[model samples]
Target: MKYFKYTQYLYLVASILFLISVIVKIINQEEYGLQAIIAVGFAIMFFVRRRFVKKMENNKKNL
Candidate 1:
């Protein structure tokens, strides 16, 4: 349960990074492909973190 807090922070950071990548791609015509790839990676990490955090919380309750 305590460590779940860290996962929550990770989710926030991942979301921020994803948004930043999107913004970077939108503002700059060049390197759009790189930015898109980064954004996709961040998005995947964000969702994974979200699911892991939920699982952790559930496990704590089961304890």
Candidate 2:
């Protein structure tokens, strides 16, 4: 549980940084490639976390 909380915190920080970068790039009229990559990366992270949490819940029910 502690580890999960830590991971969640890390993801939150990463998401904030990604958003900040995207905003900065937009303001500077830079390319959108980096922003797209960051968005995809965070999407994948969220999907993975959701799957893991679901699996954990299933395991708890089985126990």
Estimate the TM-score of every prediction: 0.62, 0.66
Model 2: residue 62 alpha-carbon error in angstroms:
1.1
Candidate 1, residue 50: Cα displacement in angstroms equals 0.7
Clashing pairs in 2: none
Give per-residue CA lDDT, model 2, range 17-49, as digits (tens). 887888888899998677668766876786688
Q: After superposition, how far is residue 20 of candidate 1 from its true place, in Å?
A: 4.5
Question: Best by lDDT, which number?
Answer: 2
Q: Candidate 1, overall lDDT? A: 0.70
Question: Residue-wise lDDT of candidate 1 within 1-63, one digit each (tens)?
Answer: 577567656656765776786787678755566656765776677677778878878888999
Angstrom error of the Cα, residue 62, model 1: value is 0.6
TM-score of 2: 0.66
